[model samples]
Target: MFSSDILEATVTIIPLWDSVAYITMKAVILDGEWDPRPEYECSETEADTHKSNNGSQTWKHPALHIENREKPTPESDEVLVKVRYTGVCGSDISMTHADGDRYMHYSAYVNLPNVIGHEFSGEVVETGEDVQSFSKGDLVTSEVTSYCGRCHMCRNGFNGHCENFEQLGFTIPGAFAEYVAVPEILLWDVSPLEKAYKSKDDILKAAATIEPTTITYNGLFGRAEGIRPGDYYAFHGVGPIGLTGMNVARAAGAGAVIAFEPSDERRDLARELGFEYVFNPVETDPTQAVAQVTDGMGVDVHVETAGAVAQTYPAIDETLAETANVVHISNAGEPASVDLRQYQANAAQVYGAEGHTGDRIFTGVIRLMAAGKLDNLPLVTSIFDLEEADTAIEQASKRVDGKVLIEV
Candidate 1:
């Protein structure tokens, strides 16, 4: 499942010594507490640690670093994955950021002091006795949202909303380290990518990207009814999610895909990816630009990856075509006012999208990558070693680059 070169670099299996293995793998960890804030209201679904309402607006990571971590052991139905590469997602950056008082800027469905990462790819090194689907040497990438297949939501065909939820990298030990134990059911085969990519590193990079692309897939197609052939669409941000969505939207037969971003680096990267219509949202009114192109007909799909709702939604309001599908995949903790009457005026609909647990989200994306329709590896502009995971997340927080990866 892994090249010999990678095995030496990622896997460090030391001789078991007593009850404590003095030599452990390295990982990026984020620690936080359940201190509540007056402005915040606790949710019944709030993580076990933060179900009370007395902390700040968000939980901050007081301690985040690359530290020694014990390797994981797979459960009866799980497989131990030797993570080769892990992408530094926006949520990782958010969880790692904190003010002088340790107040976080982003927090929802977050519980920490665990390894901080969800987007990853790896080779199966060990499988439990009861694990039937996967085996040693299997190349795989698992879902960020771990869903119990037998849950009510899963049985009802909404596996993404499974009640027994524990988000990898958020509420549990994640793939930032040398290994992760994931149930076989959630794992997706990425071996086909090995044939498509030129090298083992390249294959892992592409596989590490699968999670994000599938997320955009779920948000656009699964959650928002996708786009119609020749339907005009626009992405409000050109971050990882937006970049992948633009390509996915095009592959789904979008007539034109436009990108609106404030980052110059990201905008240029979008253009480099063959997206002809790229604009800096700060300098250009996307609504006006899109209006000029569409001749006031507007776009059939408007994707919101720009977490700045106050800034992006106004443009979405004016640029929404009739029966448009407005999908919110970005997480912005603060609320922004919206002109909801537009839905009625335009006969459009809005979708609250998150999680990539079902809807063939992983299958579609992996197939697209294998078919050469999606090249997310180019989206990774920066790379850092696993021991420098903190630096990787810091770089991601700048928002000046595309996907930032931590190669283990």
Candidate 2:
């Protein structure tokens, strides 16, 4: 038995081997917490201790560095995952730049020297004594945000807004490494993918895309009073999340799925993916175009996946049908001045949706995927090795194309 104290919590581990052993694995670490203090403000002893434990040294405060860390052992109720593939998200790009004032301020739960990749899929290599839902060799992906079950929001079934929430890539160590330890409650059993998919690589790729799809699912179903079968759906932005929204909207029996994108590449990609009514918002007026397509009835549902609130909010109000629901899924940052007159005139409602309700949404997404309704392989346009994580992030940050994955 092996036991260690981390952040005042006692974690117990049972080695897979009969003998005690230590293994070092590669990881990307954000060297310091979001503190206004200078790099030199950290004591030499503290830095030295961190270097000794994590096996590398860096002086760049709030910067990402590649290092070797001892493979973490799972605590009771947790499982150790051998990461296979991880997805790079827009939030990861923002966090990489360490937007201390705006975005990072909202993510105050993030700890220092954290490992940061949240959307990942892997095989379970080990399980703690108290872990009952998973076993070694199980294929899985997990809900990165964990909530304290006793919180008022959790008790009220709003776990995504739990008063006490800690996210894996933010508040603690995440899956941008060879291995990660996560609580069992957050684990989703994707082992069924072994049979559902054509190959292991296909399953891993699908699993890596699950988190983003779930975010879109939550926005459409969980946050927006759910979508109806014959509703006309409109999406602004043709990026990964937006494309996923298109697929999900179709699966939900949307009468029509329309998209607004300025990028020719993205518009072509969407057309290739079977979207017939895509328009260039820069050239064609979004409201006029949507009205022309819908016979002036306007869209039943409008989703803003583009992070430009100033642009998307107006487009939504212009294109929304009477009694339509507009859901904003992107993190545009700060409040934008929206002309609510149109929305009020049309009796439309706007909702700000963020994060998924953990496994609940994950289960729904998985079911959709299994039934062949949520095919995301077309969106997995880029892939890189674990060593090329920075490049992967760079590609994703450009926002010029589709989903990017880092194969661990």
Candidate 3:
């Protein structure tokens, strides 16, 4: 492992003085050498070819450092954001996972030596001349995927599958900096969040969650059509997404939330979020636990956020209700055998979702936050300054807390 050279942003009261021009101060970038696995000798198989393209399965001694890179200036249709707060995602850590690491799970559309961070909330420090909808001081959080709106997939209301796309912090520079240039169309006004949170700094902290929260939002609502009122939900993981998603399901009127996590700490965090039922799948049978709690009615909405398909899918298969919806949002790399017969027997639907685009995903999440309906802010258990981000990433690897954020 790269020893958790993490990247995040901490709350910084930006001085948006009229005459002071904003310039990016510093950035956390990833630079490493590729070292492929012996098995990936470029055989004709797709998996082998895919790994071959990435130059290997993992990097070599990937290092994270605060470097003073050339500042980014917005295009005519873009705005320069001064990042205030950012959340560390697992994908960010995978960038630094080295050849000898126990596991390296991310390696698609990733061209490194790139600045890190895709989940962020910030202030608009400058706007391009053509930008009209936003001014310099607007509080904003934008989409991380840079998708061309005119593509066929984008035009058909499936922009998440946009044929032309660039993932922030993956292919390009992202938000782990003093500034990130964003196109105006991808920006969402998060100022309304000020009403729900007493502190502007906290609101910025909350807004940084918009990206990951929407991952679950897109999977459950946009892909699976969401849960009906009074429906029972079963969450396979209580990580940040599960914790925030539990709130999403509740705010949408889910009658009860049942969470199963292998981590004792995460299960406890689920309870802290006010869920009445939380279990450890490692000890108890998740399917039987759900059956016992719901009196055999089973869960109507099944969520997979643990990235452990082998463990979660079987429970999801056994505990599904009639016409149930199974939403897989975890970024699982390995394929698992599925009992397709169960889906047919129960008349259930399964939706595979990726990325947060289209379907008003961002808008709905911001609305929930603005209305004081989301309490997932408690998931943000740790916050660090830009200088201590290395320590932040180290802590994030523990996967014990709901979230860890860096204040810029």
Candidate 4:
């Protein structure tokens, strides 16, 4: 029996008083269309108010301090998530020390004291009243980029490149906290994992790898000559994404997956994972090694996932068959200088790829895990709690092999 005006009044102060007397009384008057005094209008809960006023964590500005702020409140078009796990990305390492964030400058809500970690998975604790697609307690992950939806790119279904896009872990508040507020559209339920893995933990581990895997997927499938079963692909870099790409390319039906890596540990993983040839590009000429393996003909597809500056143009030369597609999946910031003279003679194509929604590839990885085609357990090198975030970052700086996970 609540009237619209009264309901609004009650909502205005719900965050302050948690008791039934105040709430019910407010609801009663709201039912009668009586507006509450402006002085009594508590817009945010004490927790949220504290956070807004005082920087919450010790790191304060960029790093979150939960003691200062309350768990986030969901907006009408947003959902509140209880973060379960968050993955540390290579970009995070660079951003922590970089003088500038190139992508955040392109967003609408790039503000300071921002929460900054994008690779995550969580459970839906609450939803805004206007939200209808999801309910409480749904397990989900999301497309980290937040788009304005009305923009040209978004209208055309390429939300990833929306003019007013706001990305998590960079511009806006992210999943590093105990709770995070995310747009409903960006949130995706990973509940399907229950049927896909031995347990949800397996999926969470797999989830940590999704962002990088999507980068590889988009690089290979989104724009390329096209991938067919039994195509030979040469992959540069055998880190997590490269390793994942090795399997993804194989799963997509590559006849042979050749890997180039300097780390002996990673090289072994590549061999164990079924890569046809593992080359120590640091010891021998990667181009020569790849050429030797392919009998001088060249592979059908070449993927540059390694950010190694030295491997840039050579990766192009090594992977491009007469009519091959050379895709660069990793972000190597240095300006690439190539002699234009070679362009006329080399019969090949080149493409640059970046961030992804990741759900499609994530689903594929899960399916691979379910079918026993891929193993998620072996990928994790270490796990840390939220309080150990700094320590985890410090450890990751050492470049220990495999993935580093933050167990929230």
Highest-lDDT candidate: 1
**TM per prediction:** 0.89, 0.85, 0.88, 0.77
Cα-lDDT of candidate 2: 0.80
Q: For model 3, what is the alpha-carbon lDDT of residue 30?
A: 72
At residue 190, give the lDDT of candidate 2. Answer: 83
The candidates, ranked best first by lDDT, are 1, 3, 2, 4
The residue-level lDDT of candidate 3 at 46 comes to 29
The runs of at least 3 residues in candidate 2 whose Cα sits more than 4 Å from the true structure, single-residue gaps closed, are 1-22, 32-34, 37-61, 98-109
Model 3 residue 283 CA deviation in Å: 1.4
lDDT of 1 at 350: 87
Candidate 1 lDDT over residue span 234-342, tens digit each: 8998898899888898888888898999899999999988888899888988878898778889989988998899998888988888899998989876687778888
What is every candidate's alpha-carbon RMSD to the true fold? 6.8, 7.8, 8.5, 11.2
The TM-score of predicted model 2 comes to 0.85
Q: Give the Cα lDDT of each candidate.
A: 0.82, 0.80, 0.81, 0.65
Residue 378 lDDT (model 4): 70
Clashing pairs in 1: 35-55, 36-54, 36-55, 36-56, 37-54, 37-55
Badly placed stretches (over 4 Å) of model 4 are 1-68, 98-110, 339-346, 358-374
Model 2 lDDT tens row, 1-408: 444455235223444442224577899876554333343344464454432211112222456688877899899888999999999987677666544332232223345678989999999999999998888889999887788899899998877777767788876889889999998988899866655688988999999999888888889888897468999999998788999889999999999999999888889889988889999989998888888889999999999898777787777877778889998887765587777898889888888898886546888888888777778888888898877788888898777667899899
Off by over 4 Å in 1: 1-23, 38-61
